[model samples]
Target: MQTTQFMITPASGKRLIAKALINYAPVQSALESGTLVIIAGTTNGYLAEEILSSIGQLEDFSREKFFRGIVLPPSQPRTENGRLFDESGFPGDVVIVDGKWKKGLTIFDVADDLVEGDIIFKGANALDVHKKKAAIYIGHPQGGTILASLRAVIGRRVRLIIPVGLEKRVSTDLDEIAMKLNSPGAHGPRLMPVVGEVFTEIEAIFCLTGAKAEMVAAGGVAGAEGSVWLAVSGVKQEVAVAQKLIKSLSREPLFSLPENE
Candidate 1:
């Protein structure tokens, strides 16, 4: 098999992920025939951008900044020195499709009417690679939207798709981490175990390039931090396609919360 390798910046990764989500057969079907609710985090914001741009609706939302759902550090980013979503929630940006109706409904409203084919796109804070599980951080006293969204996901069997990057990988067991983390434990940020269809850069490559991608190396400096170095294995044509697609997404703009909203 022909093998190809390259470095994918975080911004490019997000763009590839957005295209993958849009191309996913299940996501498209649900959006067309059923409900496809998107709970936007930083990464999912890119997915939203792809969806909007696909329909030529990018002008509807502020292209200047991303409307984020729940942001970690949930405080002012040290790098940007500005608060990212001062008061974030799961209602950041939703594409709720309810049969003949389509609108941006609240998480609570989406939760009540969820069904098996419905899709809940939620981002995570960390991923346990060894166990193949992901985790999210919760700060709300009531455990936030994750608590409520679980009911529909676990009870109703709705598809919970998490769009996260490789930069957030964790080494420990997510269950143990969550058990020890609680909002009242007097810690910085509480961890919550989330079970869902984990979609990371690995999945994005396959979805975007139709090639098998493996993480070979990671980490970089000089604006390359949070990048994922991947080794792709496939037919010659597939490898070339992968290369072209990745290069096309290399300059994706970073997702940021609105300066004033």
Candidate 2:
């Protein structure tokens, strides 16, 4: 097997993950004949772009304000729900039904309508890579979109796909962390361990190029913060494909909030 290494910044990783999902079995199947809810989040913003593009309806969609809540630096102001204080331009979640983009709808609008074979794409704040587990941070009084998605996921057999980056991978056990964060006196956003297929950059590489990718290192300076160094190994052709694929996304600009925000 031939091995190759590539440095993928968080933005590039999100793009890569989104590219992989463009041809994902579940997503393709859902788009053809079922419902697909792309919950509003930073990472899912990239995914919404890709999926929309795949269906030739990329026009009128912008990732700039495609998030409900986001994590910002200490200097930035946030609401109790961790969203920016000014939530005026917040776009609703991307809900696509039967290959049509249902504008102005969210999980709450269609959760009860989803049934078996449908899919939901939600981003995560933390991941347990070894166990393939993921969690979301919730500051809403009621559980957020996750709670609504769960009704279809665990209750009705709809699929939940989590497109998270390797940067969110955590060493601690998610269930244990959830326990602490959900304790009576716990302060701050609570963590909910979610059940879903955790799709990260590693999985993106394999899914797109048939190469196995292992995150060998992480972290960087300047625009490379939260970057992951991946060693992709496979047959000569596969590694070559992986290299080409990574190159196309290496220059993806860092995700930034709209200037008006």
Candidate 3:
């Protein structure tokens, strides 16, 4: 029951989650013999890099332009879909099959081909950590990638993994929030409550190092904005491993948005 505390910035947390997911059982299984789709988002960008690097196919891949939509500062202009006005440089989603990176492909390109035992990794905009629920914001008239991924996930038993950060956590029930946001009178992006395995920094720490982690507190200034204070506890060896792993990511460079994004 040895416990250790660590401060994890959002950037470092993304790296930690990415490191953990590379060793995830379902991810490993899908990489070797099944379809694994990594939907483009800020968090998934990190996971994509880790997964791609593990298979020696990291070339030509950059997180800079990996996202389809993004949340920018108040001053930054964005479309109704939360995407930058300019999207000419956007790359397609990361779709890996049989351990090879299928360059220039997206879920739509292979959603019909996916079946049971396949896995999809998508990012989330809101998370109900206590209830283990996650949801995404949709500005598309015909739903979005979640709809595409759901055809296989709910209809064909494909596994869906939601990789999100603790910073995105919300205290309200997602369904309730969805009700308000999706209302006819509501303005801006609608919320879609999704069902999947919610993987956060807590889960990431456990997955990678066998240590239990809890978000004890949050917030900071300077480079610590959106940072979380994690209290990790477990066996002596596991806590040691968690400490080392967190240390390795403590200096993960601050993620920067590409020009005009």
What is the per-residue lDDT of model 3 for residues 1-261, given as tens digits with 9 covering 90 to 100? Answer: 899999999999998889889999888999999999999999999999999999999988999878888886777655545676777888899999999999999999998899998999999999999999999999778998999999999889999999999999999889999999999989999999999999999999999888999999999999999999999999999999999889989999888876555
Candidate 3: global Cα-lDDT? 0.92
Please report how far candidate 1 places residue 219 from its true position, in Å: 1.3
For candidate 1, what is the TM-score? 0.86
For candidate 1, list the clashing residue pairs, or say none. none
Candidate scoring better on lDDT of 1 and 3? 3
Q: How far does residue 152 in candidate 2 sit from its true spot (Å)?
A: 0.6
How badly does each model clash, as a count of residue pairs? 0, 0, 0
TM-score of 2: 0.97
Q: Tell me, what's the RMSD of every candidate?
A: 3.4, 1.2, 1.3
lDDT minimum window of 10 residues, candidate 1? 78-87
Q: In candidate 3, how many Å is residue 60 off?
A: 0.9
- Candidate order by lDDT, highest to lowest? 3, 2, 1
Task: Give the RMSD in angstroms, all C-alphas superposed, for model 1.
Answer: 3.4
Query: Candidate 2, residues 140-229: lDDT per residue as tens digits?
Result: 789989998999998899999999999999999999999999999989999999999999999998999999999899999999989999
